[model samples]
Structure formats: C-alpha cells, structure tokens
Target: MHASVKMQFDAIANDYDRQRKQLIPCFDEFYGMAVSLVECEPSSKVLDLGSGTGLFAGLVMQKYPDIHLTLMDLSDSMLDGARARFSRTDRVQYIVGDYSEYAFSGQYDAVISSLSIHHLTHPDKQRLFHTVYRLLRSGGIFVNADQVQGHTPAADAYYRKQWLEAIHRSGLTQEAIDSSIERRKLDINATLSDQIGWLEAAGFTDVDCMYKYLDFAVFYGKKA
Candidate 1:
C-alpha cells in the first residue's frame, strides 16, 4: 500500500497542483478555512504532514512568510514540485518520508495537513493524532483539511455518489479523473465523529470540525 501510494503520487506530481481545484468541489472555502485556522507567530516552526506538492504550505507562507515551514511526503517527486513552487530559501525545508512513521525530532508551533491522511487506516490515523499532540508546543494548533467517511453506510455511499457527480462535471480530463479514482482506492476514511473522538483522545482541546462540504472537511484543535 505504501509503495503504491508513492508510485501513484509520483506519477501525478507534475499535474497535482493544477488538478486540485477541479478535483475538490469546495476548493476555495476548504483551503481558505484551513489556512485561516493556522494561527501562529510569524517566525514559528510549522510542519506539514503528507505535504504533497506544497499547495497548502505555499498558502500558509503567503499568510506568514517568515514561518519556518517543513514539508514531508512519501513521494520525492511531489516534493520536487514543492521545491519549484517556492523560491530557494532557508525558510522552507522538504523531506521525503512517511509522515505516519517518521521519528520527527522536535516540537512545532502548528501542525497541518491537507488532502492526505485519509489514505491511512483508521488505527494509523488515530496514532498520528496522538503523535501530533506530542509534537506540538503548548497552545499549538493542529488542522487537517482532508476527506472523511459519512456517518453511516448509506450516507457514505451518498457522499461518494455526490463527489463522483461533482468531479465528473468539474472539467478535468478523463485521464486525470481515472488516475484520481485509482489513487482513491487507497483511501480509508474515518467518520467525523470517530475522528473528533480520536483528536480528543489524543489530548487536543477545542476540537471541532470547522467546515464540512460532503466528505471534504477542515478539522481543528489546539494543544492545551
């Protein structure tokens, strides 16, 4: 599963950024909410997990240019795209590794992820929330802008149906759509309630879903 994710993302690295707007039905509001919740000092250290193509990090940089941003992903090709997106600067660093298992060295002011994490199994996702809690400084925030399963089997099916309908009419090429569907085979989304419980169990405070549009949602919490 890990190797498959790496290979598939590497194959689409070059076009990942361009296709995001079409792939996500609520691209603007989704990202806008995520970035807005990333409140921290201007020069604080921020870590982005599964930071493919650095799209979310770039937006965060726009908001806080002096921030020390670390982008980690399983796919080096995706980080290559990130390297091109940002200028050569000491403020940005890229690492090619699995976010779920990496032994990160220090704490951060804020930890964020986008369109990733759903690829992990439910247990992995819960473990990751605990990891994020431990990695955060006091009062630090964690925000995840990713997909989730619906409350029930029928609702989950409906969410998938709606997403498919939206994406089909979203103007992406057939090849791109097909590739996305193939990549989605790796998704193991947890329900919103389960995720909130995981966050709370991980020692996060003020835990809440800041926004939700179908399966795409922005979850936010802060370390106390």
Candidate 2:
C-alpha cells in the first residue's frame, strides 16, 4: 500500500465502521453474499487481506466460529479496531503490513478481502492474485468484495453518477459524503472482467463475479 493511502485510512480508522453502511448502498447484501460464498469448515484457516477493522472477518467468524483468522493490513490504526473487535478471541491474529508485499506464513483454506485491493495499481492487482493463488491450499477459496471500473468510458462515467446518486440518498451528512468522495480518489480499480481473467490466469478455477451492483462486486475463485 502507498504511504498516502495508509495515512488516509489511518485518519478514518475511528469512524470507518460507522461510515461503511452509509457509504455502501448495498451494505448487508454485499457482505452477506461474500460471507455466504466462503466454503470453509469450522477448523478452516482464513486470511483477510486489507482486513480493515475486521468487519468482513467478523461476519465470517459469525458463520465459522472455530476458523482461525489472520487479519493483514497496512494501517496500524485500522488494525487497532480489529484488535479491539477480536480482543477476547485467541483464534484471531493481526499483521500490520502491506498485503501486496507481505510474506504470508502458510497456506489457507480461504483468503478474503473487502473494499481494499482496488488501491493497488493494475499490475499490482495482477501480482496479488498470483500471490493469493499460491497462498491458498488446493481447493481453497479466494473471494474479494470490492469496487471495479466499468469496461467502457461511458459506463465508467455512469458508475460514478449512479454512486453519487445513491450516496446522496443514503442519509449521510454532507461532510461525511464529501470525505468519502475524497477518499475514493485513491482508488485504482480494474474492470470486473479483467479481474476474473486475472484469477483464471493465476491458475484459479471456477473464477467468476459472484455478485455485482453498479461498481461494487464480489469475485470468487478457487484453486484446483
């Protein structure tokens, strides 16, 4: 992750969770579908890349309580929220570092990320997919719940317009909406189709976009 992006997230660490539902129009269904697609046993090992505040992992834990989880991110302050969220549990672990550059310790049954990864440059996103593929055990799942760019210029413009409309109707204060818009300037999103292709190129099977609404999408794939 870039230092500027890390600093940006650090500044919002305190209010991230509160702002999430307001910023994402399809909050519940977006995350709920991602968690549902995770095929893991109670004892499965999971790694959450860019696990801001552990929100997504928290959802996964609700479904698989005994799964051991490692939350990795570049911002310490963001991880602090996650630490507090899972403070009482020994099954959760934290690593403060860039997910794109970190050396993962072991293979996992499932690797997940949310509202992250889009910050990476296109080349970095491709490399990260390869890394995630290598980090997963055979038959393991990899799911990313994040935003994507449209395939065409006009479609991209429409995506932004639609997002602006939804945010305005989300009941957020003007100041909150402005802050969210500013934060999105750091996004380096790829098209949904490109990401699916990248996953397949990285040797993942059953690669597909499991869910999508405007620009937000949940991509799912598995190692053969």
Candidate 3:
C-alpha cells in the first residue's frame, strides 16, 4: 500500500500544487483555518507531518516567516518538490520516511498535517495522534486539514458524489482527474467524531472540528 501511494504521488509531485485548488472545492477556507490555528511564537519550531510537497508548511511559513519547519513525507519525490519550494531558506528540514514509525528527536511548538494522515489505517492514525501529542511542548497545537468519512453510509455516498461532480467540472484534463481518483484509493479516512475522540484519547485538550465542508474538515487540539 505504501509503495503504491509513493509511486502515485511521485508521478504527480510536480503538478500536485497546481491541481490542489481545483480538486479541493473548499481549498481556501480549509487551509486558511488550519494556518490560523497554528498559534505560536514567530521563531517556534514546527513539524509538518506527512508534509507532501510542503504545501501546508509553505502557507504557515508565509504567516510566520521566521518559523523553523521540518517537513516529513513518505515519498522522496514529494519531498524533492518541497526541497525546491524551500530552497531559498536554510530554516527548513526534510525527512523521507513514514511519520507513523519515524523516531523523531526533540519536541515542537506546533505539529500540522494536510491531506496526508487520511492515508493511514485507523489504528495507525490513532497511534500517530499519541505520537504527535508526545512530540509537542505544553500548550502546543495540532492542526489537521484533511478528509474524513461521513457519519453514515448515505452521507458518505453523498459526500463522494458531490466531490466527484465538482472535480469533474473543475476543468482538469481527463488524465489528471483519473490520476487523482487513483490516488484517493489509498485514503482510509476516519469519521470526524472518531478523529476528535482519538485526539482526546491522546491527551489533547479542547479537541474540536473547527471547520467542515462535506468530507473535508480541519481538526484542532492543544496540549495542556
């Protein structure tokens, strides 16, 4: 599963950022909410878990220019794009490995992920929540801008239908759309409620889903 996911993302590494907005109907608000919740000092350290192409981390950098960011991803090709994205600066670091199993050193003021954690299995997702909690300093935050499963079978179907219809009309080429769909097959999204519960179980306080539009949601929590 990991190999297939790596290959698919590697194939689209160069074009991933270009297709993001069109593929995500609520692109602006979804990411905007995530960035706004990354409360920290300007010089704080942050880890962008599953930070494919460093897209989310880039937005955070724009908001806090002096922040030190560590971008970790399973795909080296994806990290290659991130390397170029932050090439002008020496404040960023890259790690090519599975974040779920990586033995990261030190702690961070904030840990954020975007459109990446959904690819993990349910158990792995829960374990990662605990890892993120352990990696943060007290009062640090965790913001996840990613997909979710619906509350019910019918709702899940509706969300999928709406997403499919929107992307089909978004003017992407047939090949691009097809590739996007193939990549989505790797997604193993948790329900919004379950995700919130897992965060709480991982010792995150004030856990909540701050924003949601269809299956896409931004989850926020802080270490106390």
Candidate 4:
C-alpha cells in the first residue's frame, strides 16, 4: 500500500461515514451478495481481511451467530471503530496487519474483503490471492466486493457519470468527486479478467464474477 494513501485513510477515518453515506446502498448490496456466497457451516471459521468498522462482519454475525470471524486491517483507528462496533460479541478477533505481506497461518472456511484492495498495486493484489488461497481450507471461498476498471471507453464514461450522479445526489460536490478521482485513481481499476486469472494462478477453481454494477463488482472463487 502507498504510504500516502494509508495516511489519507487515517485522515479520513473520522469523517468517512459522514462523507460517504452515498456508498451505503451499493455497499449494502455488495455485502449481501458476498455473504450469500459464503459456504459456511454452523462452526465455520471465517476471516475478513481489510475489515473496516465491522459493518459487513456485523451483518455476517447477525446472519450466522455461531460462525467465528477474525477481522484484520492496516489502520489501528479502523480497528478501534470495528472493536467498538462489534463490542457486544466475543466471537470476533481483531488483528492489525497488511494482508499483502502478512502470513496468517491458520486455516479459514471463508475469506472476505469489501471496498478495499483497490489502493494496493496490482502485484500486491495478486499476492493477496495466493495468501487467501493458502489460508483457506479445501473447498473454501474468497469473496471480494470492490471497484473494477471499465472494459471500454464507453463503459468508463458510463461508470464515471453514474458515480458522479450518485455523489451529486448525495450532496457531495463535483470537486469532491474529481478530487477522489485524482487522489484514488479508481476509474483505472484492474480488469476483472486479469484478477480472475490471478486467482486461478493462486490455485482457486470455480472463479466467478458474482455481481456487478458498473465499476462496483463482487467476485469469489473456491480454493481447491
């Protein structure tokens, strides 16, 4: 991860919910889809990589209270928010680390991440697949909800305008969208095909793009 982007997230931590409320519907749908994809038994052990504020983890917990989750993130402040959010439960464990390099030795039934990893460079993204694959038990899945690069110029324009309209309708100014575009470079997202290839290379089978809306996408693959 870029030091600058990590710092940006640190600064945005307090205001993130206030500034990005428009992302709720999209995030809600994404998490729902990812959670639906999880093939968990009553005693399944899941790992949520890059878990922020425990929002998705809370949903998963509500749905399957018996399932266990280990949430990991890079920012301590995000971990604090997550700890507070999941305060009622003792089923969750938190870790502060970079998944790009950290080696989690234990096996998990499912691995997940949401709206994270775009900040990571492409190579690191690929390495993440290998890590997830290694961490999962056989037949386990990795579900990731995130942004994607467009397939063509028209698609790029389409997603760009859709995102702009979403932001504008949410009361965020044009300058805010433009600023995010510049600082985050989200529109140039890595292609879905390449990411799928990376997962396959990491020894996953049955890879699929489970859901998508323009730049927003959810994908998962079963580890063999």
TM-score of each: 0.98, 0.97, 0.99, 0.89
lDDT of 1 by residue, 53-132 (tens): 89999999999989999999999999998998887677888899998899989999999999889989889999999999
Off by over 4 Å in 1: none
Candidate 2 residue pairs in backbone clash = none
If the candidates were sorted by their TM-score against the true structure, best first, what order would they fall in? 3, 1, 2, 4
Candidate 2: regions farther than 4 A off:
none
lDDT of candidate 4 over 12-91, digit per residue (tens): 56656556556443766776797788768887898998787676676777778898999988877777878887888888
Give residue 104's lDDT in candidate 4 (0 to 100).
74
Cα displacement (Å) at residue 131, model 1: 0.8
lDDT of 4: 0.78
Cα lDDT tens digits, model 3, 1-224, are: 77778888889999999999999999999999999999899999999998999999999999999999999998998999899999999999989998989998999999999998998889999999999999999999999999999999999999999999999999999999999988888899899999999999999999999999999999999999
Evaluate model 3: give its lDDT.
Answer: 0.94
Q: lDDT for each of the candidates?
A: 0.94, 0.93, 0.94, 0.78
Error of 2 at 142 (Å): 0.1
Worst 10 residues of 3 by lDDT: 1-10
The superposed Cα distance between candidate 4 and the true structure at residue 94, in angstroms, equals 1.3
**Residue 16, model 2, lDDT:** 94
Rank candidates by lDDT, best first: 3, 1, 2, 4
Candidate whose TM-score is highest: 3
Q: How far is candidate 4 from the true structure (C-alpha RMSD, Å)?
A: 2.3
